[model samples]
Target: MIAIDDILEKIVSKEIEKKEALRFFEELPEKEKSYLVSKLKTHLSNNANSVENNFSEKKERTLKAVTELQLNEEHKGFIDQMAQKLEKNAPKSKENASECQTYFVDQRRTGGLKKALKRLQFHLTYSECDGAYLYDIDGNKYIDIASDNGVNLFGHQPDFIKEAISKRLDKGYPLVGYTEELSQATKLFSELTGHERVLFTQSGTEAVMWAVRIARAATQKKKIVIFEGAYHGLSDTVLAAKDQFGNSIAMGLGMIQEFADELIVLDYGNMEDLSIIEDRADEIAGVLVEPVQSRNPNNQPVEFLKEVRKLTLEKNILLIMDEMITGFRVSCSGVQGLWKIKGDLATYGKIPAGGMPSGMIAGLTKYMNYVDGGTFDYDDESMPSVKKALMAGTHTRNPIKLAATLAILTEIKKRSSTSENKTDESNSCFLQELNEKTRLMCEELNSFFKTKNVPLIIEYFSSLFRFKFLDDPNGVVKELVFVLMRINGVETSPSGNCFLTLAHSDKDIKSIIRVVKKSIDTLMKQNFFYISDSIEEDEIKEDIRSTISTIPDMRNDPEQESIKNDQMEKLRKLIISDLNNFQEKEVTI
Candidate 1:
């Protein structure tokens, strides 16, 4: 037998193909395979400089573009003013929190434009949350639009969910035990999702991981198809991206290349992309879809989803709907329920757990039977029959989580019942009312943007909405927009995705719109959208002098000050040349 170290070395050196390496990896004992995978991940991390060169280049370009744009006279003045305002209002508690965060590894602080955000001291530390509002440490209140990434369906600290969790705690629930709460939660989940069997896990990522495992086990096929631009959690199986050459690549370091090899990512809404699924049907175990991708909420693609469902059924592939962000919040039954399109298997989290960290995989008996070898009764002499797939965790059925989930589902069921009885589809109900409110809010914002020619639009599906740029597809303006929104008393996600909960009143919605409008107005006043073609040379020189004046003092270091002056002179000349070129182009046009 070949040694695991040798196999890993061969994999890292490209001496063995991915498929061949995976085969060897599978033949090893489970513990050895895990060790080998860890070693391989370390190698990938050590060699990430080569793999991540493209990302580094893109980051550099973004930094350069933002720096140059901010150097404009009006923009520089605006930045200076905002910086001063932020400094004055800097929350001491939040500053302490940010300082403490440096001791731990947090993706929230490290991801995106980290350096820029750090320079602005944009870390927000909330002291309390109630309904649709967040109170920062310094007693400043902002309308909460992030919605805890779609987990707070009813809003933060709702009474019913709080009571449920408190009651469960009073009962002294064990970490690992079968309780009546578990049965009730699972039953409610099955009824809501229209699935025969349900399994609980700790998070949405776990639910998705097991869903794929069951699909692969049931069909005896390897590959899973996912759409581009849809986030299905942080599992290695689904962490893939398409390269410029149209080849599948791991989205981040430490993911095995063999896992990327097993994924087929296609365009989300393009009709032509369906043919690839048909062509590769034999190898596909399942097609994973996020009915409404959170990043691009505008592209609902109902027809595309229906066609994908049909193809999966025809091709004997399991349709796995990843409704982590859409479940419960979109409707009582989620996107699958709203569209009346059922999947063979579905994964849910977020609102289903009512803000608790939980995940669920629900599916037909044929597919979910792999979880426990087809349910058997004590009365029967029959034994476990079906081949089982591994699905176990220490806290899979925590009573507190079950209690919270059951409360949320029961509330949803009551509301759904009321909605179903209404003669008119548009009549008032819990979700319907919330969805309608969201629609109106987005319409108002979009209309305002159009009237003002702001080059921004808000798109929504149900209660989920995202801010999209009219032409800034690369997201050059997004960071600045989010910063401005935060400063104007509206808190949103870094990605510009936000949700509306039942707790968000009409007044709260109007306040959100006002903040957005004010932020846009500020940007416009700073000439962020366009640069003037005509400018006097004296005014340009004054702008350069003002820009230099904002720099920190270098009085004690004369040589360094002289070098900085030379660099600033070159930058001023470059800016003038670019402005002249722009004027020439305007004249030619």
Candidate 2:
């Protein structure tokens, strides 16, 4: 028996490629090969920039294409058939990707990008994806809503996208240095979005990096004004502006404090703060803002955007819009059109690449095109800091990915335009049902809270929604929300916010709602919350009405000091009691 370490050492040490290693492992027969390789030791770098570029793992739908509905008699029958198949041809773990999975698992355990899902659990696996479903290690299916976080917009292995890639493959090399496909794709993307020209980069962070460069080039300014609660990607220069809670990632080693020192941070949608920026417009190159704050709060009001536009125009500073998440999912017209604001440059990614690593910087000619030749081309290929600007890495213009990109944009428009962009038919027939289900679940909980007078923020936007357990993150309900969603086959990202994909059917939404209701009932029973088992709609309505009734009547109440104090005291006591109760039922999530 050739030892497993001997085999993997040969491979990792460059003694053999993956194909050669596979052949060598094939001769081992049984779990012997897998078990051996799993024990081999290795190390991965945690330095921020040393991490493999993952901008292309765009969000994707969270399920499988197996057409398995709520485990009824029909699915039960399919399970029996599957059981028979398994009995006849049980998969030998040694013959699978056990080695690769093990490597990532061990590496992620030490804090790498591909964090291990579980030591025993298969959170990391690779499989051929087709259509709306995602297949994992053991062929388990999940309905992806974070659309792989916005690529694969038209779905994985979509026929149109696949055919396009196939057609491209039939031709010669799809990418040959810097050429026309880049420009043509740019034109198509820009034409649709109402931008004059598009500058193609390979990831969202790259788009952000270039946006700063363009602003610098046009204004001859050294500083950029970024929002406090924004994420333009993990580029070195952008690290100063932390994410929602302010954990400074992208600060591993290469990112010096001086680099972040150049970026001026401002609050999101603070119109008056523009005066601070306005007083320093000569020094400030541009104001970068996300149209909708995705993930953290995942909510940006339209009025907030209008104020941003007004302030930027008044200050005569460049306004760079980061629309990475809102481009495709928010509306067919993208963020600017959805919110009625204009931007000099719109940083795009997520869905535009069809689940591929890609990014685009779209802007007008006067400012965007300035950096091409007439300005600083300070060696992106030569200098380390600048190298990122020039490097698209391998497969930047992969024919397969391009084909998928073209298909996704076309399909999204077709579905949206024909039905007038998420019409009653689509919503009532599909998304609305899911949205209502979620809304109802939250409504039920909030009603109970209102009766208890517990303050909560049950945020919702269209079919995408998640209740932030801010009142008490230590509570059991926060953890149950994740566990129940997974058990019910409605898996969402751990990041609190969720986006509903077209792959999720109305029936599936109902199932999710059923699971949520049951989960809520469970949590209540566990005293995770103090909601009653027999919560009635009338009681809920009355609670809502009473809450509304306390709105202070600003028109009549010139002296509302007593009301404010009373409300504050009520809130304070409720919070104290809730936290005490939470301590008894909390799970250390």
Taking all chains together, each candidate's TM-score versus the true structure is 0.77, 0.62
Q: After aligning candidate 1 to the native by TM-score, how far in Å is the CA of 529 from where it should be?
A: 1.4
Identify the runs in model 1 with alpha carbons over 4 angstroms from their true place: 1-70, 114-117, 420-429, 473-476, 531-589
- The clash count of every prediction, one per candidate, is 0, 27
Taking all chains together, the TM-score of candidate 1 against the true structure is: 0.77
RMSD of each: 15.3, 17.2
Q: List the residue pairs that clash in candidate 1.
A: none
Ten contiguous residues with the weakest lDDT in model 2? 41-50
Most accurate candidate by TM-score: 1
TM-score of 2: 0.62
Candidate 2: list runs displaced more than 4 Å. 1-102, 105-132, 178-184, 241-254, 296-298, 374-396, 416-458, 474-477, 530-589
Residue-level error in angstroms, candidate 2, position 378: 25
